[model samples]
Target: MKRIFLAGLLIFALNVNAQVQTPAASPHAELEQVVGLTEVKVDYSRPNMRGREIFGDLVPYGAIWRTGANATTKFMIDKPVMISGKELKPGTYSLYTVPGEDMWEVVFYTDDSNPLITEFEEEKVALRTMVEPMEMPMNMETFTIVIDDVMADSAVLNILWANTVVPVKFNVMTDAEVMKSIDLALAGPSAGDYYNAAVYYLNSGKDIEKAKMWMNKAMDMTEKPGFWQYRQQSLILAKAGDKKAAIEAAKKSLEGAKAYGNADYIKMNTDSLKEWGAM
Candidate 1:
């Protein structure tokens, strides 16, 4: 019984010793960014240079790369976007690239379940584009993917490693989205809807008269309007060339702001009142 107990205790000790934790050779990374109205996400692993040659020798010049180490890189977007002038539907995809001396072929494959890609199927490719590689001034140690040069309707997806940088340009349909929202909101419009639509029109340099009308309607529907609401009403009225009404609205906003102890709104209304020669 004593010998059997000793053997069981030895096995338990060995099992505990074998369960050792170690750092990954290539650490995983995830990045998410909002480009215009679209949500872009990337999941991959970053491998270091480790004093080894990267592009030509280690990764090879004319082979399909997973775009990262370990499992294949996953790319996801919430909205449809035009990638390199080609439309790509919203979905998760495996990102792969074929590296060359001057240009690189970037591909988005529909299949994302596979951790490692052993074969490349042409039919599974959703969108493929050739992007020119730029030589960086300094060397980069770890692989990195970034969404850069963001604008209201477009952004650039950049891949960087070693001394090479590849950029892919994509465009989002912001105007289409805004128009759709406007149409839907007008179908069964609420007070908040009217206010939001008015603000959008005011900021986008649309018809100031229409914005003023909508802002007035929004204020009329509310039993008691806030100081900020009165401030927007004043701006819209001023833009629509109703100086007298703008001054009255600003005065009301100034009174409300004073009661609420809001320093910012008070200053804004006071400034506007002075500009309109009401103060």
Candidate 2:
């Protein structure tokens, strides 16, 4: 039949031009959160050394480079996270990087759900540190992987390729263990991440009237709006003076922190509820 349909259309045009010339598949970078009900997922993979010349010969110093391909570079923690100081439960890890011209060796593979289950099993190490390489001389003709320094609690997990620079530190969960895991994740999930763990126990250093009773029971299981739990229960009801329910919860959290663009948390709740009678 017409030469078997021209040999199956020339083998499907050479398998779609060999998948459009292959190179271009790096993506699965992540950084999830939820420390109370424990749902931290930090899968990461970065493949960029474009202008080449990295580690002796394009990543060949001790060999074992799949660290940024199909798998390896994961860290899906869940509850308890206070590393380098103990308390490290709830797992799923496999993060490795051994690049060294100066310094870089950070492993932590607990191996699960397949990170090649310890590729060659370095005794399945659960922690192997040695970090420090933010060398600046700025050139970086390519290769970039980011996850910036976030801290309301803490975060930082970068690893830019050539010109090197590695950082990995994310310690979150502790305010009596996120208020006993947000009272066990508010009795049992509906999920807004435990209403952000009741607005992170009513904004850190908690205990403002038990964080306004867990921000009014996480605003009755969240419908959302509770902007900073009405600005920390209107500064704990204007620090007990109760300026009429703290100016009505600081005008409902300054209209929801100006509809959430959060201009510096709406000027700190309109300068602490309209400047407290300015005198």
Candidate 3:
């Protein structure tokens, strides 16, 4: 009985020692956002301050950092984006930055085989830009990165750590996408399609005759055309320098707008008619 008890005690001690857990110093993090139609993703590791001086002592100023604690920080973009007015192609890149008192050098390297950036070859750099660092109001114990101030075509990529914030502005091309969609929509033209094409042509100053043809088709296809469509027709005619037809279309738009009880469109048509000498 004594021998068995001693063996059981030895086994429990060995098990407890083997089960010791030491968590990672830096934890992995991921951020993904959509700016316009482009998808931007970032993968990195976050390291805490742990009550030590971070900037000048641990991270070091004026030196390249992996932008994370462990492994190379991966930045993946689905489509082309403009950063600080410079264009970057769509792909995965390794993000690195050189910390500074005022300005920081941001780098996107195509090759990121080295996590420490110790073998950073200039040839592997895809894009490089400089940005100013902003002082944070409060100390940030853990490193953080976020996509902020998102607009229709632009957003800011922010990095916050140790009371410092660095922001990089990026823009996505929306016009090209809108134009492509317009082309596809106009391929099999419906009444609404014709109206949209006419509006685009009229506004862009491209072929007034085509705009007139499309407006005519839109009106003919709709058994009861809306006042807005007639409004577009009037605008198209006016741009085509057909004052007489523009005035006639404006009158039709005014009548239709009144019938729909749309005060705004009624005012629009009334103003347009007065301008065209049809009131």
Candidate 4:
């Protein structure tokens, strides 16, 4: 009987060994892409939510959360990111959160010292901001992350989960240094695109003269003074309180728009003139 038991134990051990497996890497992972001329690469991955009710339960309402499963959530930025006008340096940061019923506290932890565990402390934060989550029309079963409406100086960092929509405005400028970068891009290839970007930036309440300077450089390039240049120049003039100049420039821009057969530009020019109380 003893010998039979030994044989059975050996058989069970062999079976268990056969079933054991080793993986090549961690299951938690992300996608990496460089954005902006700064070449800031943002690496992100969707972790296993695993049927967890994100709000008011596992995360708990009115409390801070790391936002997802694993060690404090991480946002790896190769270049610095500006959050709500606050400057953050380029580095790997552990993201923590303060979950609430109406809103959520999004925090950036400076210490990349811990694993994806609830190990972060309040002292480790580099910057933090409370952002209200908007009620999403449709329920989201899985977590989603994306960068929307990217520009030369900013992009909207968006997160959707559990029927909630959260957006964080990420800016590339928080320092005098960013101005230097703008100057550099203005002086580089694709200067026209950079100039056009600057114009949009100013129109949207960003750097005004920076936009003009970029446009000047772009217009100087071999690129034709097409719809983009005309539209931006008109916008700058309008913003400068020159209604007549703006309207005239906008009309000229319409000429360029017609040349390109881009209805969007034509519409934008007409709509903008109206918005500026010009037309």
Off by over 4 Å in 3: 1-20, 189-279
Superposed model 4: Cα runs more than 4 Å off: 1-27, 39-53, 115-120, 174-279
Winner on TM-score (1 vs 3): 1
Worst 10 residues of 4 by lDDT: 37-46
User: Where is model 2 more than 4 Å wrong at Cα?
Assistant: 1-39, 50-133, 136-156, 166-171, 178-279
Return the TM-score for each candidate structure: 0.63, 0.24, 0.60, 0.52
Could you tell me which residue pairs clash in candidate 1?
Answer: none
Model 1 segments beyond 4 Å from truth? Answer: 1-9, 17-19, 190-279
Best by TM-score: 1
279: Cα error in model 1, Å: 72
Candidate 1, TM-score vs. the true structure? 0.63
Look at candidate 3 and give me any clashing residue pairs: none
lDDT of 4 by residue, 90-126 (tens): 7878766676777777888887755554544657778
Candidate achieving higher lDDT, 1 or 2: 1
**Better by TM-score, candidate 3 or 2:** 3
How well is each residue in 1-279 modelled by candidate 3, as lDDT tens digits?
A: 999999999999999889667888999999999888889999999999899898888989988898888787888999999987889999999999988888998999998674565556878888999999999899999999999999879999998998999998889887788788899777767888888899999999999999999999989989988778888999999988998999888888889888879999899989988888877
Query: lDDT of each prediction vs. the true structure?
Result: 0.91, 0.65, 0.88, 0.71
